[model samples]
Target: MAFEGGERGTTDERLTARLRTGVGERLGTSDEHDTLVGVLFCLPNLVAFSIFLLGPVLYAFYISFHEWNILANEGTWIGIQNYVAVLQPAPWANDWAPLTDPTANTFWYSLKTTVVYAIGTVPLQIYGGLAVALMLDKRVRGKKVYRAAFFMPMMLSGAASAVMWRWFLAADGIINSLLPSFLEHNWAGDPGTALMGVMLMAVWGGIGGNMIFFLAGLQNIPEELYEAARIDGATGWHRFRHVTWPNLGNTNFFVIVMAIISAFQVFGIALVFSQGGPYYATTTTVLLVYQRAFEEGAMGYGAAMAFLLFCLIFAFSYYQYKNRDQAEVGY
Candidate 1:
């Protein structure tokens, strides 16, 4: 009986060894094979990225250093002349004041507008989204319906939303009609209010998407933390300050970063709303890039502006990423 048991044990061990060897061979359990598989899986995305994004970016960079003729489909090498032209103040300006100088460089004016737009819209989008998200996160009736309604604006294309807002802010449109006669004015057509009108549209359209992001982050936070805070007799505001706000650090960081980037890149609404009108009051950097590249046919100058914009965005994003530890929440 002992001999039989020993034989059976030997057979079982041999079977297990064979099975392991067979599986390993079938799976190609080698470092080189695994790397090859990973490469294959990534090939499609790499190809698309190269063709669609990398190629154009390289071409634009090449164009930025030249006098590019769109009609000729060629360029004359100028070696940063385009960048200089974009950066240099106007020859007529007596002082370095781009903001107040009537003859200041268009690039500077456009850059200022872009900065103003970012400042005006980014904070509103962040805080408004957070406020709405907090309200929606509660145990309220029709929560899903309200969430869907809030997010509906985000589903519309930028151009479409801009067109709708243009009508809404027109001289005789719904906004003016609702306002008191003294307060009512031509929102989009007036120089003083054109950019503000565009900002209003941007904030309205943007808050919903940011709200969704904040909502997702709120849902991901563990409930036990809240329960513990409640057990400690923490008030609603205290619980939010101690638990919710801290936990939402990453979400806040992400929302702020994206909001700033979007604000800097604002074009479609400004373009469609006022066409950068009322004496270029709403001419953002990107809109100016378009006017230079397509309308005025200064492709190289436009490319230089675009390159600068890219650098600015990269610098900001990099700074945020480098300081990401500050934005992260610890349990």
Candidate 2:
């Protein structure tokens, strides 16, 4: 301590520095105490995330490194062997065939189907959602009720929705009943229509929630921004292009990512409706992983498939991040 400053003064300076930060000054009545309290409050959530999320992911990776069969209680240390089997899917042992075998399997076909489903579902969902949200954002009669009605499907349990749609898409269901009584026959039973039917069910169930999100984002946009654009002789399309659309970039990113992930991860619908199809056509990566782990009792293979899925999601998300910025600039 300097002689000019007593020990107490130095300690007070340290406390003041700790409490007063750039953005968290509002956290405390006085600057000094706020900082410490705010930091202490944040600690619990950080710790919980580490324990629950990060810990499990790390553990799963560790498990993937081993050859584990939960039912037989047999596993050996085989570094990367599971991953190899999962990707290769070549000819396997007597007990393992190409389709069922985790290793040396042609999972690429399933991956292709998943891509098709995602591509088919996402644009329809996003566009349909935006249309409803636009109408809801307007001054319509019973608008709140209409919004709630639209959002109801999202509140329905995913598995329950799948079951309900399974009946709806089957041969003798409502859709077929309305079909010219000729064309509407057995949609889900036919391989050609089965995958499309699943895609339609997913989009139908998912659109409303994204509509609410888009509506909120649209509503948050300043009315004056539109008014200003109008004053500058901007047409409706031009106004949206210059003002409303650019303002909604973040919400668009959020909706797109959520929709894409949901499309890619679809399993319950396939489980309830097609059951991997007329023949493995609708077997998504998630369903494949589930079967390998639980149904077929290939824990090692399942873990590897799960890892590959993680990689796919990570790649898609990264792609979106890259493209979203470009979209914003173009907007």
Candidate 3:
């Protein structure tokens, strides 16, 4: 009986070794198989990005050096003439002051308008979002409803939002009705108020999205930190200053960068709301690009401007990313 038991134990040990060997063989090949699967999964997205985004960007760069006629679907090599035309003053200009003689340089005028729009909208959007986020973060009745209401505007398409705002700011619209007779004016028509009208629409439509971002940042703050602050006899303001704000550094950086980029590329609101305006007051760089490219059939020149705009955006984004430590919160 002892001899039989020893033989059975040896057989079981052999089976276990075989099982281990099988598992090892399967594990050795699994990594390569998983990598192949991952590549297959990502293949479609890579192809789509190449075709839709990367392809056009490269093509635009090529077109920028040529005199491309959109109607003819052809181009003639012009070297840097398109860029020179965009930068040089108009033939009729008496001086080189682009800012003072904005009309003498279409690119400068549009760039100034774009900068003004950015200045007008970026801060208000960021702070207003933070404020709304704070208010909604509190324990209050109907918080979800308020959140939905605020976020609803963000879900609207840019064209839809522009159309809606255009009506609201019309001569006989709701906004005008609220004002006294003498104070009321054509918000989208008058040159003085046209850009302001666009800015107002931009801020209103933008705040809700920014608020959502701020709310997410606010919620991510650890509760333990707040409790600790309170235990240390910290007031609400003190807690926010030292704990809350510091912890929200990453969120703040993201919000600020996105806001600046969005401001620089603003097009739909200015296009649909003011139509780039009364006396070109709202003619932003992007709008000018569109007008030059399609409307006026200066495709190459427009491509040059578009490439410059891309470079400008890249420079700004790079600067912010390089200075990220300045915005970081040390915990």
The candidate that achieves the highest lDDT relative to the unseen native structure: 1
lDDT of 1 by residue, 1-331 (tens): 1244468789989999888778879886865777898999999999999999999999999999989899999989999999988888753464657765424788887888889899999999989999999999999999999999989999998889888988988899899999999988888889888889889989999899999999999998889889988999999999999889888888887898999999999998888878888899899999999999999999999999999998999999999988876744544
Instruction: Pick out the ten consecutive residues of candidate 2 with the lowest summed lDDT.
Output: 95-104
Query: What ranking emerges by lDDT with the best candidate at the front?
Result: 1, 3, 2
lDDT to native, each model: 0.88, 0.80, 0.87
Worst 10 residues of 3 by lDDT: 91-100
Q: Tell me the deviation in Å of residue 99 in model 3.
A: 2.4
The per-prediction tally of clashing pairs is 0, 6, 0
- Report each candidate's C-alpha RMSD, comma-separated, in the order given: 8.5, 8.8, 10.0
Error of 2 at 258 (Å): 1.5
Q: What ranges in model 2 sit over 4 Å off?
A: 1-36, 72-74, 89-106, 326-331
TM-score of 3: 0.86
**Evaluation by TM-score, superior candidate among 1 and 3:** 1
